[model samples]
Target: MKQRLGAALAWLEDRTGLVGIVRTVMQHPVPPGATWWYVFGSATLLAFLVQVVTGVVLGSMYVPAPDDAYRSLEFITNDAPAGRLVRGMHAWTATAMIVLIGIHALQVFLFGSYKYPREVNWMTGVLLLAFTLAMAFTGQILRFDNNGVWSTIVLVKMTSYVPVIGDDLGRFFLAGDVVNASTLSHFFTFHVFVIPGLIFAIIGIHLYLVIRNGISEPPEAGRPVDPATYRAWYHDYLRREGVPFWPDAIWRDALFGVLLVVGLLVLAGVIGPPEVGAPPSPANLDTNPRPDWYFIWLFAALALLPPGIEFYFLILGSGLFFIGLFILPLLANRGERSWKMRPWAVGIVCVIVTGVGALTVYGLQAPWSPDFATQPLSAEVVGATTGPVANGAQLFHEKGCHYCHRIAGSGGQRGPDLTTIGDKLSENELIWRIANGGVNMPSFAGTLTQHELREIVAFLQSRRSAPAPAQNVPTVR
Candidate 1:
């Protein structure tokens, strides 16, 4: 039976030349000293495969309608056997793919692989990156949770800032001017099918370019890439000292790929997926919707930007980023490949990574998140017995002051802590700040009644480091 099967396979191979094609791909030449750094691209590809398989499994059970989507996901997460694991794998792998792709791109940039013959490869890779992010964004909306819907609302608002045809694009995104049944369906279609399809096609082209151009030789100190002579030189260099990609370079990639998949599985089993918050509720003013971790930096950027210039940052910043990436290969396509010779490149990378890291940390803390969890100021913390001081503490929470101001380590950090606020300001100063807001704070003059304002101010005056007699404040009648 084995002999017969082997003979049949040989016959099929002879007819189709599939074996020859596999052999050719396996034996493709790679430059000498191709080390663990080369494994990142393969790892990224492995992550993409994980995402595809897991996403398909998840899609089978996921409902795309706004009404049933959250419930269906809850069912999958709690009722279906192994469904949580599958969903976790998909979510984790999406993040892993984005991170791996970023590292791969950074590797390419640092090694100067985008120069000369590999320009198109880099361009395809950038597009793939964009498509991967698009998939992530659309996938977020499929969750049908408050965070997801709010993210879409934020996205639509941002889209509406585009210079030309902004309204049309925004309307198209929201599926008829608002997030409804059609909105969820639109995102579901793009997430599971359209963006992934584009990624698949672009991956094919990216691989074709990689094979045609050959992997860039590890950067040398002084061997600057000259477009005219580099190709012939690389060919000659490979002929002299190249190894078959299958056994020599592929072993590291295989080891890394296996470890990555295993790690993802372990993470899925341990951490599982992000919590699916309450179903979409546009009217929920308390919702502090945030994107998944990879986008937290951008979310932080939007949050921390000066209030009115959000559109400028959304448009001009994004425009400059893509423009810079597109023009990179054209600007310095033939130059020194060594990072040692490129201080400006190193500086740019440092700045971007540092900025993103800082922003992500801030986003995680989310100081701007409403302090709905803030407990009312206790009498002990307030050091007050009665009168306006006690009423003021109640007014403090009632007026949403706790949402922005921290008090005795209980409230938010958006505004200055009022734990020892009495040490910093007089009653008049407190009243002034409350009546006239500064920067991100909202003024309460139009919103608060005179008695209410006095009560709030009385509460602020009582927040002291030590117990003290309440000041004899005149009653605001």
Candidate 2:
């Protein structure tokens, strides 16, 4: 890094009359009036660096299967020694990166730094902000927790507005009825590589443009070079005010970035990523789910809405908002750098910020969810019947209970592991279900004799208290 920094500084100092070089932009030998506030961009760049490195580390450890996902995360957090460190760094850095970007963008916006030649820069920035948030949302759900699942549920429904393609889109995104390995892998690839790749290209483009068009300073005064005569560059300009990009630029970026990483590490050690209440199970239809904080507002918004009107407006509103956001650069490409004259453009930006902020705040505070978490396994859960649950036992095996629920650690996860069924369900609850079946379960009443239901109920619960083996060894002295 030091060698690269040296080479970059040499290259910068060698530029031919590079008037827009960092040193010149500062005004003083150091950008005369430039305040530390200007460092927001530098800080943002640092955070991005953290995201790339940390995300790669996280990707290395993460498992993309929905069923295995919760366990994989647990392993990352609790079992794999470095798993916690890697995941913690990646998760917290991601959050910090977005926030830093937002602060940078907002600072520039408020200061009217994009008034003239910087409009394109600011516009590109806004798009970047959206991308940052997009990655955040996708990464969060890719966790596939009870929260992740339900968050996707609400999101899928919201997307129902993509004409007739909505359902297909949702299915495609989820990789099936619920999030699956495909969803995890897809999101992982996007989060760690694809999106970051695009972001990198954008960063290159954004920086190159910054170089081409001189940095925009506050509305203060300067030699108002007519854009036509301002032969842009700084190689020669270095003799007048330039500093080596080594100790000057790269050093600051690296130092601050390290500080940010250390700070986030401490935070993660203290707080940790919020754990989900439970892993999602489609078989348990009544589970109450919510999304992570970044999305709490959206969840809250969905709650506030009177079902029909709320979704319709949200769909339409979000679509139009994004469309407008993407097209803003072209719309403001008049190429003017006069912040004083760009009230309307600035206003548009403020409007977007305000609207998004208000919605986020509202969504976070609103109370909107099912009245009851798990519908109490409704009395109708299994339905009217008195019978031997032994039939239910046969039904269990026949219906693939063993495929998902485990007597111990043996079974598929197509549903929740049922090793502890007795701890939760009563005999009546078990028997009623055997006779009638509930939720994803098929009714055994019509197929099983009353005695069969009894036997199966007995069979399913019997394993709960299976005896422990006698001790084999004593504690070491």
Per-residue lDDT tens digits for candidate 1, residues 59-171, read 89988987789888898888889999999899899889889999998989988889998998988888887888888888888997766766776677677778798879988
Best by lDDT: 1
Q: Relative to the true structure, how large is the alpha-carbon lDDT of every model?
A: 0.81, 0.60
Worst 10 residues of 2 by lDDT: 370-379
lDDT of 2 by residue, 284-359 (tens): 4344455556666665566556745777788888888767755654564333444456577568778867866787
Number of colliding residue pairs in model 1: 0
